[model samples]
Target: MRTKETVPEEALFAHHQAAMEISVFGKSMDVLHKEDFLRNEEFCILVKLRYLLDNGIEEYAGINESIQLLKASIEAKDSFVIIDQTESRFRGGKQQQFYQFVEGLLTDFVSTEDFQDRLSQQLRETLTQIKTQEGQVALRNYTEQLQKLAERPLALKLLSLFKSYNLADYSLLRQISELVQQLSKKDVRDYQSLKPLIVANYRTFESLGKIISLPPQRSNPDTFMRMTQVLVLEYKYQLPFVQLANLLMVIKRWYQPYQNIIAVREQYPPHRYEQPPDFQTSIPGEAIFLKYKTWLTEKSTGVLFLDLGN
Candidate 1:
């Protein structure tokens, strides 16, 4: 029996690791592609042009002139050189015509306008597309169900935090649903049994947040260290020592920098800056615990307990 249970647990763990790797890879690729696009002169021109159009700047002459200049710069293999040379020419007492023209084009392109109509149009298009997609209907229904289930005062508070921080995910909703189902199956349940499950669920969200919000500069060990400290403090009394130790080990492994720490430190020394104080209550674990406590208190009546926990 032990072996059978352990095998499934190990398999689930492996599956989770694989999913994390895929998520990381997708995020890295997105960052790389964005950097590449930003560096491309054509892409830069189009983005500026899109901004102009979105802002209702349809001056044909200004737009055409700007496009020609950008295209010429691209052909010369140095788009930024035009901006640099134009500035230098102006300072050298040469003709200011080119510099003024380019400057005006850029200035007018970014000038703001009321974008309410454009925003409304975008929303209508999005709604139309969502209505056409069959899967989106199901997704919307699921979201509605989640919102309803989250209406309990305790759950509402936690849900609001999760939404505010972009911490909520489909997996979290699924986990909550499963927990509720398990509780329903029990012949007798109480605060003690439910408390551990809530803690476990919150811990999962904390772990996911740490993984998803990993610093771009992985050489910075401070984030991982802070995560370790919080996890240890939060779970030390609540969980078995062995389990806590294993969780810490997992965090340490995930936090390993892609680059060597020695090399990174040598390249970038510490700066003399005042660091912000760490707020312990802001951590998901503490917030979730407090909300759960509030929920327990609010539903303390024996009848409420009998319906849900008994």
Candidate 2:
């Protein structure tokens, strides 16, 4: 239905507007895409229609006429009403529950264990393909481990949820990636928050083992990488002042040679190495240098600075 016959111009515009609103609100696209509000249905539709009208892409048409036309179509018995199960509620009057009929079909289809078996098999095959050398070793190893764990009945039963709920999509992968990245960066302070993501990632790896051998990654995981680096820094630098001072000293010494190297750029810039004029005199320079040195000393702990030999 999402990509069948071309949606009417009005409906397509409405979908775009609604999609933007839902995304901004951080609501589920699935829910907002198929909602059927009873009281303000026309009003909500007109809001989207109005946006299209003012945008000058399409001829501006007043929604009052459209509503009347729809009402007339219903009176003539030419239009049909389609209710989605997830969003609409029927009072169950003389009207047959349109929502229930669809839900019934879905429930029957999803309840079958046969489809689950096929899906699991498909997943396993997909997972094998991901294990190629082009993929990350950590992800490959994780998938392999999952495959072994799923051999157990209990593990298989629990993992059936991925097949049962049918959440194996880009969305699920995105969520899993987020959870994993968060877990990787977190200090594991409480340990409880860390456990769920760990367990879920393990289970997801097992389920993905059936279909995808390669590990999933963010479209751009640079942020995740930087965050993980900070986590590494924190873990490495969690020490007393004495040790941290020694660490800083080692880093400063390592950078000293490069820092001292002069660039052979056409000419040397004036005052490149001299202290500021305000600190040129012995007394003033001594005072300013002490202040600057103290500030640098305070800032240097647990930090690594690099000189490009310029």
Candidate 3:
């Protein structure tokens, strides 16, 4: 629960503890590797050094020198982490690469007690660069595929619907995964309202002998949404559908913030909406921009307002 700014030493000390479970910079480290922590000799060295640093002991195995190596990042002739204080979002800085650098620190430490101890002077300076910069473009990029998908029309449409496409979560797919609920609706509209139509049609089809009678379904909006999607499959070029909570598994089997969102969804299942009169592909962006909002900076300019949402 520590804010990024105030989370330095507590995070270090927390990692030092034996539970081997803690969150660092918004990412959780589970104790699945707890057994390994007790046996890893290399990890003991690093973590013990961290313990000394945090307690202000001013010594590591009494050597009074930094044993921590700058092995990850290499420069032209030698290896070193980039110490750019000014490189950040919107400044053409490699914020994504920097995030990976910080992520690498946690990744290495966790695999090793599976974790840490102290905020050393150099560490304090390094952690300063790290905490405020997590998942900054939604902590950005998944790979080359992310770059390709991010520039596509479909990615824009999906992001438009989800609303919280972070410049922090860079990978196009993880951004999509985080907001998968929005895509699961089956309303043939945003996919939330399908029960009445399917129920009505089921009875009608049965009465007309177009289909045989069967036991009632364990009825719910979710069921209705799936049942009505076949219609949209037939809609073809005019695909207007929502798959209400279809990918709830991917959403629920995640870590925090997401677990919080899932808890809320459980407390209140997807809300019901009237079945749309007809399927129509949703127009992207705020209607006000399309229908009313005008160009800014100058009223006389004829440019329409654009909602290039994340």
Ranking of candidates on lDDT, top first:
1, 2, 3
**How accurate locally, in lDDT, is each candidate?**
0.32, 0.32, 0.28
Cα deviation at 203, candidate 1, in Å, is 0.3
Per-residue lDDT of model 3, residues 1-310, tens digit only: 4322222344334323311221221121121223343353333333333334334353223211111100000000010001122234324234444434443443243221122221122233444454455423222322222233233423322222222222222232222222222333432433345455545444322221111111234233343343234223223212111221111122122223323323333343323322222112222222222222231112565532222221
Instruction: Write model 2 residue lDDT over 120-175, tens digit each, in one string.
Output: 45435544544344332423343333344333433333233333544334343444
Error of 3 at 276 (Å): 65
lDDT (0-100) at residue 184 of candidate 1? 39
Candidate 3, residue 175: lDDT: 27
Question: Candidate 2, residue 98: CA error in Å?
Answer: 36
The residue-by-residue lDDT of candidate 1 on 35-55, one tens digit each, is 233343332333333334334
Worst lDDT window (10 residues) for model 2? 78-87
| TM-scores of the models, in the order given | 0.19, 0.18, 0.16
